[model samples]
Target: MAEITASAVKELRERSGAGMMDCKKALTETGGDLEAASDWLRSKGLAAAAKKSSRTAAEGLVGVAVAGTKGVAIEVNSQTDFVAKNEIFQGFVREVTGIALEKGDDIDALKASPMAQGGTVEEVLTANIATIGENQVLRRAKAVSVSQGAVIPYVHNAAAPGLGKIGVLVALESDAGVDVLEPLGKQIAMHVAAAFPLALDENGLDQDTLERERAIATEKAAESGKPADIIAKMVEGTVRKFAKENSLLNQLFVMDGKTPVSEVVAKAAKDAGATIKLTDYVRFQLGEGIEKEESDFAAEVAATAGLTK
Candidate 1:
């Protein structure tokens, strides 16, 4: 049996939000496998539906660029928060965001495309590393465009002109006047940044995600010892609720926290004197799922000084 350390138990507790003893037990039952232990805890109804609480990602920048009727938001991540303040790194991110706006949503294509200053995007990134003196990367980019209405961009914690740590792009598609929809779209984009909805609608969400939610809901409903007919209804209701909460259009607006986003769009349309639709939105929070390596300061110092234990 794998030894369940205190740190492991603590990590499990933090991830699953279960009691310490329960976390320890889950770790023991799963032989120290974190993901399996989480699933074990959930199977016993000891944990929440979400798998684990990811580490706080507070170290990156959000970038936004608006061009004509389209807007792009890009997130570039570095190992340390200090790199975010570096002018060279910030400039690269801002330039790349503009490139993203021009190139659209294909990350690989964007990487291959030419940058404004000189070489290809990849070449410029290589040069940036030499200049910035830190390992930098173009993490992810997303673009939102509208044929008629407006695509508004929002950057939270901006480090430069159109670059920050959390970027959001909202596309409002309508024949409405830009004067009316621009502010509303920007507000909605900010809401998207805060809420981080899974998708625009149920159809946009991945099949695997839907299946996972369904499985969890079905399992929870089955444990009630209710009739199959009642359980089916309960599961369906739970699924619909899940979709409403996770889907962007169905989600309650974070700003007001009362009206659904769909209703907010409709109200904006009425005020703008045209039919408006929230065609799409893109939000990119830097280093969201990436885990950086934790370093031991004392060990590093010792190694640097060439001390032998």
Candidate 2:
């Protein structure tokens, strides 16, 4: 038995595209031979995962789990929508979402975390890929917690209890009880799902996004054929309106369509006789940013059949 170093395992992993643990095992089994280890992984069908990795995995579930005041939302993506309905895939998402609640939002940390099932999350994910014959990715995870009030979760278009197309977690920090916070948090979470606010507040909005908006505003204001100072004021107003519409706290409540989210929460707190602050939130819409590849099935099948015209 040869000593299998970390470098050896890493080289084998890169060559075979298998999980770290699987690579290490392959190296140990092949007496630290990288080529043989790659062969071993290929024989096990684990290396096939690499071939499928290029496929866009933008169709899966956004899973949410809440434990007490803490809540987590995770997006686990699959190559096809049919696989999203698979129990194995859904079970993996549920288990991983639970692990994410404990592991926090760092994707690397979540992947490396040990699962109650027999292996680390990444290892299990690799095995799942081989078993399911589809590319699956643990895209992102976000966790939000409140020190006192409640972190409420809501799933829109739910495929299961906590699994869905959209998962939202709203953290309400307050001295109020769950009874007061739960309803308010839920409504806000639903609003987040529907409105897709870019940030919690104006300050939280992305600088680049603001700059882009400003540039667009500046261009459009200039097109008005007005004076320089007037154009500047116009640009300012346009940017301000953009920020207000996109920021969660400033955005009008979806429920009422008139009251801002900040006001809605404040009114809820007032009605409940408590100081409730909407602190943080996470909205994981499944495959929100991934660019999915489109292919014609007839053309693909014809190509596969070697019947090119």
> Residue 293 of candidate 1: its Cα lDDT?
68
Residue 40, model 2, lDDT:
90
Best by lDDT: 2
Cα distance off (Å), candidate 2, residue 44: 2.1
Q: What are the models' TM-scores? A: 0.75, 0.92
Per-residue lDDT, model 2, residue 230, is 99
Would you list the clashing residue pairs of candidate 2?
Answer: none
Model 1 earns a TM-score of: 0.75
Candidate 1 per-residue lDDT, tens place, 1-309, comes to 999999999888888776576688888889999999998977765564222122333465778889878888877766579988888777777778777877786878987899778878766765555455455566677777878878888878777777777778888888888788888888898888898899999889888888898899999999999999999999889888888898999999998899999999999888767999998988888788777668788997999799948
Question: So what's the TM-score on candidate 2?
Answer: 0.92
Clashing pairs in 1: 61-164, 61-165, 62-164, 62-165, 62-166
The Cα local distance difference test for each model comes to 0.79, 0.91
